[model samples]
Target: MTIAEDRAVELQEQIRLPRSMRLRLTRNGLTLVPITQAHWTTQRRIASQIEERLPGWTAVGEFSVIPPREGYSPEPDVSAVPSDQVLPDASKFQEDLLRFVVEVVSPESEERDYSTKSDHYALRGIEAYLVVNVLTARWTLLTRPQGGTYRHAVTGDFGEKIEIPVEDQTLVLDSSQFMRV
Candidate 1:
């Protein structure tokens, strides 16, 4: 089998969402379900915060990363792309143009978000990745991707403010508003 096909089979095995659930593909090889209410709350809060903090940037929740094929799912819980970065079509956003991706880990999603998704984002050269674990009330930020991995990672409590180094300036992320799962 081709490498992509192998990865697709692997992802289908790892994902636990129901067969009836709708799925989206990430440039990474994974399948994802729609966000739960708790996940949505956190995503919405973070998106709003980003929009407020960075005026010209747009934050998207559950925005699937467009892949070359039909079956990869690495959709971030929340994503921020520059407002001016227009795609030829609006149906989906390109993974390369994504400035930031945030994932909220749930029991079923812990492994993929922390491992497979991280590897995929890094491989695609995504600038920033944030993982919020509402169940644990902790957050982790990964940045500076190199060789299909992040070179820097910072972990902290939910209430702590984080400095996301985007471009030259830092975009402050206020995790204080995040609701616990």
Candidate 2:
């Protein structure tokens, strides 16, 4: 087999999802964003912040974060996956996957999530990468394929509303109420 074909075959084997793991995915492939205790605190804070600042959005999902290493794609907060399609095994991308990976932006985890983790997601073509920039009390949304790297696509403050287009329905951030203003 040629080098590329050999690699693709090898990659397929490694991408299988683990039996021990419990995962949820969007129809596209996968999506997870775990909400932990700390994430709860921060997420609550963020949610309230958004609700107070904006009036129309809904604080639907919020996550407490944990540190994530390179090549990991955390589960999306919620994946709108269809029942018919099977989820691609994560083993192939474990080196590049996290089941809803959320990183606490504490000083301790700064390097891992912002620089290291971000770089890792870009390499794997992860569908979503959200940097809950806790410091500035803001959230950043990064998406789309840009020069093969996940560049800083957009930034929103705690008060702003983020409208995510899903089917005919609209998913608004509803974070305006969370803002202190």
Candidate 3:
């Protein structure tokens, strides 16, 4: 492993993060960001919408997701996985089981949400990745992962509708009431 990867593993194994914070392995190494109230609210709102639209799919918040890439573990603000796919008895969810991942952009995590996490999720072949920016009240939906990047992207301001195709069905998320910081 490279120095950054080794450090990421060490940090993951050793660090005791508080409930209000989450750690991520980025290109720069291990990084921590505090979860603000607005962030939590936005996450919950999105998750609720997903659950309402996609029955039988489990939408969880702040769960660890282990991508195929080594030394990269990201806890998306919200993740949707198959409810029937029995997961291992561990804290991390394998990327193969993840149908969708959502990241709410905080002031300190704008770049990571828009770039770093997007690249990582695409590389892992996640079907859909949504980025909600509370600062600007805008959202971006990325899909069609190819060659370690998203082949299609759609961006719009909050209050616009985002239609995400998952498991042969389309999840229509109404961002009209999504919380903004």
The candidate that wins on lDDT is 3
In candidate 1, stretches whose alpha carbon ends up further than 4 angstroms from where it belongs are 1-34, 69-73, 86-89
The C-alpha stretches of model 2 lying farther than 4 A from their native spots are 1-38, 44-104, 146-148, 164-170, 177-181
Best TM-score among the predictions, by candidate number: 3
Q: Superpose all Cα atoms of candidate 1 onto the true structure and report the RMSD in Å to 1 decimal.
A: 5.0
**Per-residue lDDT of candidate 2, residues 1-181 (tens digit):** 3455445435644665544332332123233233334444555654454344433433333221223332232332322222232234422123222222333354344455566556555655554466665555566666653544665467778677655433344445544433221
lDDT of 1 at 45: 91
**Among all windows of ten consecutive residues in candidate 3, which has the lowest summed lDDT?**
62-71
What TM-score would every model get versus the actual structure? 0.78, 0.44, 0.87
**Candidate 2, lDDT over the whole model:** 0.43
RMSD for all candidates, in order, please.
Answer: 5.0, 10.9, 2.2
Q: Which ten residues in a row have the lowest lDDT in candidate 2?
A: 90-99
Q: After superposition, how far is residue 99 of candidate 2 from its true place, in Å?
A: 11
Better of 1 and 2 by TM-score: 1
- Write model 1 residue lDDT over 87-135, tens digit each, in one string: 5456467887786688888766788789978888887788888999988
For candidate 3, lDDT tens digit of each residue in 74-124?
778887777886455556788888877898998888988888888889888
